[model samples]
Target: MAGVIVDTRGLARSEQNGRGSAEPEAALPDSDRPELGGALEALSGEILKKRSLEISSTSFVTIISIILGVALALLAEKTFPFPRPLVAAQSACMLLLFVCTFYYFLSISIILRWAPSFADCAQPFIITSLEIPPTYFLGRVTGWDACLAILFVFVAAGVGSTVMWSPVSHFGGDRKAQRMLHRIFREVAVIFGTGALSLASIGLAAHFAQAGKMWWGFGSCAVVLATLGALVARMEIQLSRIHAYYGVNRPPFN
Candidate 1:
């Protein structure tokens, strides 16, 4: 991101070069002189505001995760037993919620550590008019994007869990219907998985780029592409299996 440049040495340089001259001071253009103090104040306010919002969002997620975890635990303590598949689904949801909470906490920490600060706004510097992006862990890809991607996985898992629970399980016993539902569930899972993978890949590239390891970023990109191809093939194979079992025609993948 482009940002303000502060150059304090210009006046000193001019003074040295113009010693003994009639004009003791070099005149600076109005456009060249920016109100850095005011700019710094504005920037500081914005950073503080954003930091508060980030903390609040993470806190909300944490609280919700705790509530849901406790509720699940209580349900498990009931006398009636849950089917193994339903128990597994609920467990997966709980695990994913934990992951989402952890990811948000990590993102918040990174945001706080990198938030900009000015030691002295009055210090001589060249202030440019360019805008600077937030310097979070992922660089160009904001931390919120990655956080949302993780949450997306959690949501997808929660929705998939319905297939194993009551009401929905009524439809799950029919072989053809069950296969259809599974196909839809798998499609949704692949969609969310692909999105998360793409975001993570970009974040990894940004991380490597910031570390000055372009070679590593390139290698990771290749690996990501290979993984994506494999995901596509896996989906195709699943689709073919569903078609074979249901006596439906499989579409050509080319």
Candidate 2:
């Protein structure tokens, strides 16, 4: 009768121990699981942040360039006495500069989307040569007729260029068709913007001349400077956005 004694308590204890072991396995932390996709997403976000900062910096530089250019022109005006012919020359120069700046901006925008390779060459040329010098001269030239004529020419160039170079079959497509369009739009904007700015400057200049208020002339110059700065700033911002969208690095920002 003592041969088959069942240890039911010991069997229950063993089963409980097995259950406890399985509970720990189920509760283990999943820290070691791969998150490659999450890491990539975070990396991409960092890149975008950097790019945005870079773009902002480039925009600042462009603003500065505009300021410097305008200042130079104003300084020249105050220091030198321009004759009627010189005034005419200055107006033409201003017109050219306005056209150039416009073309530069339009080109940069197009380059951002289509042809990046040409941007480097075109942008600097537009900024240094086209946008700055003409604006400077325009501010310096004092004749009303000169200013009006320049404005008229700018408007005419804008309209004519746009029509001539539009994506129509009348304008045959060559390799530089896109470039032409860019030039057309930029010139148009510049013509309008510069004309408005010049009118304001002229009014201020006249007020200063009538009142013998030298400061008024300076104020007019300042206005021109500010307008130029704003123009460049706007263009830079546009360029920055383009760079950001394309995920490219612009100079002074990279």
Candidate 3:
């Protein structure tokens, strides 16, 4: 559980008014006293640790984006044109990468800027807020994984294109190369789908388990999971359409 620092003076004033004739300091409950506040400061260290964990997750996204950007740039430098399906895949991947980067950057920014205020809430509120970080961390990891998966798909396409069009190569229109690329794509999709489902199930279970509590923390997890689910679903659809363009069926798990 996280620690919260309430304004003891204000709390005491209110409680005194309700009780009538009691001194403000006397009206203050032992839990709301300055000694308790000191104890809470220790608890707040745990909350700060969670915040740091999320910041580290943001760094993961940044590194992945840089690597993915370089790969895309190198691919762009090539003189050969990509097939329509590959071009579409590239565009979709870049767009989703941008969305994930922006999403994570914004979240971390809010946490850094408003965390002090959030720490001033009650004990239950502070504890409930901690529930969000686990699911949120998973969502960010999924984003990082997605960027890697996109890179893999793009690299495979580039290799397939080079194998088909290279001047010295006699393997032009190579069925084996094309099939290899397709197999890799489908396998990546299956792995991503499995991971996404596991993440969703865990998030949903957390949401329901906390729904009985009187806090908005559970709702926040639900929103995070739902938004993540939507993004992954859209990517899956785009991948499926690419498969269709190449005269292949959708991934078996889909």
Error of 2 at 171 (Å): 18
Badly placed stretches (over 4 Å) of model 3 are: 1-65, 78-80, 112-254
Question: What is the Cα-based lDDT of residue 98 in candidate 2?
Answer: 52
lDDT of each: 0.44, 0.49, 0.42
What's the lDDT for residue 32 in model 3?
69
What tens digits encode model 3's per-residue C-alpha lDDT throughout 112-144? 222323322232232222222232122233332
Q: Worst 10-residue stretch by lDDT in candidate 2?
A: 108-117
**TM-score for each of the candidates:** 0.29, 0.35, 0.22
Q: Is candidate 1 or candidate 3 better by TM-score?
A: 1
RMSD of every candidate to native, in Å, equals 25.3, 15.6, 26.2
Query: What is the C-alpha lDDT profile of model 2 across 146-249, one tens digit per residue?
Result: 34334434544544454433454422444354444455357546645665566565655664565543344444444444544554555555555544545676
RMSD of 2: 15.6
TM-score, prediction 3: 0.22
- Give the top-scoring candidate (lDDT): 2
lDDT of 1 by residue, 1-254 (tens): 36977677998888877764544234555666555455544457778878766765455445544554554454445312543432333333333434443443343233222222241111111111000011121112334234534544553564355344323343445556565545645665666566556656665665556664434333333433443345455545665555566677776353
Instruction: Specify the highest-TM-score model's number.
Output: 2
